[model samples]
Structure formats: structure tokens, C-alpha cells
Target: MAVDPRGADLARLISEDPGGPVVMLNLLRFAPDGAAAYQEYSRRAAEFLHKYGGRVLYGGQGSTALVAETGQAWDAVLVVWYPSRDAFSSMVADPGYLEITSLRTQALSEAVLQATVPWPGFGES
Candidate 1:
């Protein structure tokens, strides 16, 4: 499976920008012995994330799923919040960041990166 985003993917991500902050939800399925590599990637990625005003909101290994389709279990989950879609784009486009992304690519067998939008009345009447 393709682990890296393509030009079209970036374009779509930019076009879908709703303005303001964006929280990215990542669902990852690791390759054999991939956790270590991913850890390295995460460590290196922190600098770039911070440079772009992004931070990890949550990150954890996946556990038992009470409800899910077959073959839908993920190995890990991460939620990263960015100041804006542009910030995310900039980070990914950075030359240094791109150089280190191979670690992330090699570590994941499959992954889902989704940008989440906050609902205005999500928690209030």
C-alpha cells in the first residue's frame, strides 16, 4: 500500500481547508518490527511539527475494538493538531522533513491520515 501522500493528495488537502486549526487523525498498521523505526521518525518529526505550529494531541497503540469491520484493526493511532492546513502542508513540504519521512513510510504497512473539522455545536445544545 502507498504510505506517502501524492501531489494530488496534497492538493485535495489544501482545497478542503476549512480555515483555522486542523486536527489530523492517523490510523496506522505497522510492518514487522516497525514500531522502533516509527519511534525514530516521531522523534525527528517533532522538530518539524513544532516549527509548523503543530503538536501531537494524542498517540497510543491500538487495543481491542468493541466495534469494527474485519481487518480494520489498527496498530497505532495518533492525533496531531496543526495551526492550519497550510502549516501542515508547509511542514510536509520542508526539505528536511521530507528526508526523514522515509522512516515513517518504511514503518507502516498501511495508514489513514484524515483531517478533522470541529463542529460548532458538537457538545452544546
Candidate 2:
């Protein structure tokens, strides 16, 4: 139930940079009455996200899964794109960003922060 990334995690993310923009997949499971707090955290963290060249491609509450096993349905999902993994790393390391991270920590019982790499030439016409 790790809700946040550690220093080593951040380092590995940068060291394993796959080049180009990185889209992050965030799967969140909230603690009891945690959704409101998480929303507040998102609001406060927007400035940092923009400053680091990160943007939310999509974000929404999870619904009944048409195809999935139990324990796989998330409470929320966020798809965010960053200019690069380095930008994400730097954003998480910022002192200001760090200050409000506790809000996220308190809000989620479990979370998955994953990076998604686009297929080579997949998006090209």
C-alpha cells in the first residue's frame, strides 16, 4: 500500500528514462473519506504540475469494470503526461511540492503511479 514514491524510486525513474514525453498512469484507492482530501491536494498541486510541464490527459472516478477481477477496480484513475521522466522527478523533488505531498499520503490507502511509453511510430500517421 505504498502511496508515494521514495527517493530511490525517483532516481530509478530518471535513470531509466525512455526518452520523449512520458504518460503516467495513476490508480488510486482512497482511505475512508479521503476523496475530498485528495481533490484538495490536486488543486494545490496544479501549479507545480504546470511548472514541471505536466498535464492531465484524463482524470475520473472509476466505475464498474466490464472486464476485471476482484481487487482490480480502482477508486480513481489519472492519466498525466509529462515532458519527460526527468520533469516528473524534478516536480516531485521540489520543496513546495513536497510540502503538500502529505495531503496525498493521507488521502490514499493504496496507489499506483506507473509510466506508460508510447509505441514507436504508433501515433504517427
Candidate 3:
């Protein structure tokens, strides 16, 4: 699911609890002020996420490759891991998160938050 800055359509998506493993990704585009603000928000939000079994698997302003079948380019990436879809939903429902959402919407030029089901080939070694 993609939530734009407007955040007008999150009501239905946030209400459902699918109860399976979930990954929440925050894709950060280049904006010095926005990046700084999001980092601060992320630090605080991480604390709250842990209470409900949300583990931040990886987060950084690091290089990553995005090959688009539709032919596009993406810059930096941030990823968080949640125990289950229910846990993911709970994180968003938290009162503190509501406040943070306002800040995130402003900081991020565009944000794509999606629910993913791991492929069978995922995590192969």
C-alpha cells in the first residue's frame, strides 16, 4: 500500500489485521532537511515499535539498486521488520504514531509503504 503526503486513504488499510509477518519500508528521497527530520522521527518511533514486537531489521541512508520493469530509478531506502501484520497495524494505531505521521508526511516527498509476502526463494543462502 502507498500512502502519499495527503494520508486521506489510510483508514481502511490500517484497520485490517492480516496476522502474518510484515515488512514496512520507508524510501527516503534526497532532501537534507527532510532526511534529518525523518531520522529523528525514526529514532523515537523505533522505541515504540519494539513494544509490540516490531523489530527494525535494517535502517540507513545507504545505496541500493532498484530495477524497474516499468523503467524508473529510486534513490535511498529504509526498511523495518514487524513480527506480524497485526503488529504492523498496531504500530500505526498507537497514539504517538498519529502525531509522527504528520511529521513524516511533511518530511517525505513521496512515501511508498507496502505489505509484502516473502517469496519462497527469499532468504536463500
lDDT of 1 by residue, 51-104 (tens): 999999999999998899999999999999999999999999999999999999
Runs off by more than 4 Å, candidate 2: none
- lDDT (Cα atoms) of all candidates against the true structure: 0.94, 0.94, 0.65
Reference-based TM-score, model 1: 0.95
Give the TM-scores of the predictions, in the order they appear.
0.95, 0.95, 0.72
> Positional deviation of 85 in candidate 1, in angstroms?
0.4
Badly placed stretches (over 4 Å) of model 3 are 1-19, 30-32, 62-72
What ranking emerges by lDDT with the best candidate at the front? Answer: 1, 2, 3
Residue 44 of model 2 has an lDDT of 97
